[model samples]
Every structure is written in C-alpha cells, then in structure tokens.
Target: MLYAILAYHVEEEVASWTPEEDATVMRDLNKVHGRLNELGRLGPAARLGATEGACVLRGPRKGVVTDGPFTESKEQLLGFYILDCADRDAAISAARDLRQVNPSAMYEIRPVKLYLPGVPFPRTEDGVDA
Candidate 1:
C-alpha cells in the first residue's frame, strides 16, 4: 500500500527559524529518509512553498480562485511524503519517525487509494525535475 504523509506546521514559527536550525532539521530528516531509501519505501517527497504563494480555486469549473491555503487551523501544510508500506502500521511508523525529529510539526498519514498514471517528469543530471 501507499501512504501520503502530510506535514503541517505553524507557518510563522517555521519561517522564523534560523538558517542553521532549518538545516539541522533537514539533516535529521535526511537520516530518516536514508533508512526509507534503504527499505525501498520512499517515493516522492516535497517541501511545499509558502501558503502566501498558493491559491485556492472553487465554485463552477473551479474558476473561483482565492489567495493562500487559508486553512481553518493554525497550522499550514508545509510538505508531504509518499511512502510504499506494507500496512497501516508501517505507514504510522514512518510518520512517527518523522515526528520524532520534528516534534512541533504534525504529520497526517493517509492511505493512497489512487495514483494517477503517467511517466515521471524528465530529470536533470542531479536527479531532480528540470
């Protein structure tokens, strides 16, 4: 099964982090990612941009657009991870590992019911989409 781990955090708090602090968190996360890679469970992961640069579209034909995610809560979605897991427990375990290193952030684990079919994006030499 596939799981989507949605990461949510207070935007103001995260944005206030010093570069060193942010880098330290990333390094810690990379340790978790390394283990997932070894298990061949890591899929696509991303750190989303600020909500200020995001838009919400609604209404007919989804043409009604609004600024920001404007979530109903204090936390804004900061990123997500896709993992291939054996079961719900396995998915929860992965989210738990993530939470350990990011105590203040919230991780929402959900089973992926459908994955759109398509070829992956063309990658640059560095293995990232160009």
Candidate 2:
C-alpha cells in the first residue's frame, strides 16, 4: 500500500467556534475517518495547536531553539492525516472527498517515503542513493 501524508491548512483566520458548531464539524470529519478506517486506509489523524504554541529546533547539534512557527503565512497548518491507499490516484480521490467537506481549507497530499528494513538508505528511481 502507498502511504500519503495529508497536510491541512485553514484558509481564514483562526476564530473560535461555538461548542455546537465544533461538535458538528468533528462529527462530520469523524464519519469520513470511520469510512477510511473500514477501508483500511486511515492510519492516523490529528489536529495541531496554533503556530504560536509551537517551538522550533535547528542546527547540527539541535541546539538552536526558536519561537512559534518558522515563518508567517496566510494559511496556517492546522492538522494532518496519514493514509494508506492503493496508489496516488486513490489518495487523490480521498483528498477530493475531504476537500468537499472543508471547502475553504487547503489540503496537500504527498507520498510518504520509507526505507526497507535492513536497508541503510531509501532507493531512488535512477538506482542512485537517495
């Protein structure tokens, strides 16, 4: 199975939602997640905190610590989902369904790269080191 990392970005400013509204949206999203689970395609999904709640680490020694998001952008990354699908087309289909539910949000789907067990590095299409 091909694994995809789906990144979701909110299109508008972060506004507080009423408890009822929040529950409704959550229910809708969960329903889709349940379907994916039944198909054995859903791996994991999570909604992350706002950028202000994040911390960044950088440098070879991982000694550099920075505040909040690395950069400021119009849309902030709000959540992500890991999906297992038959192929990229299947992943795209799932993304399209998700987009219909969250019409104002942006979703990015990228294949996840994995190294085979006992392999020191990932393989490349040209048979070169990745």
Best model number under lDDT? 1
**What tens digits encode model 2's per-residue C-alpha lDDT throughout 4-23?**
55555653433466667657
lDDT against true structure, model 2: 0.69
Error of 2 at 62 (Å): 2.8
Q: To one decimal, what is the Cα RMSD in angstroms of model 1 from the true structure?
A: 2.9
All candidates: TM-score: 0.90, 0.76
Tens digits of per-residue lDDT for model 1 on 44-79?
887877778899887887488889687789999999
Q: Candidate 2 at 35: error in angstroms?
A: 0.6
Deviation (Å) of 23 in candidate 2? 1.8
* True-vs-predicted CA distance for residue 125, candidate 2, Å: 41
Show where candidate 2 strays beyond 4 Å: 11-14, 115-130
Model 1 scores a C-alpha lDDT of 0.89
Please report, as a residue range, the 10-residue window in candidate 2 with the lowest summed lDDT: 119-128
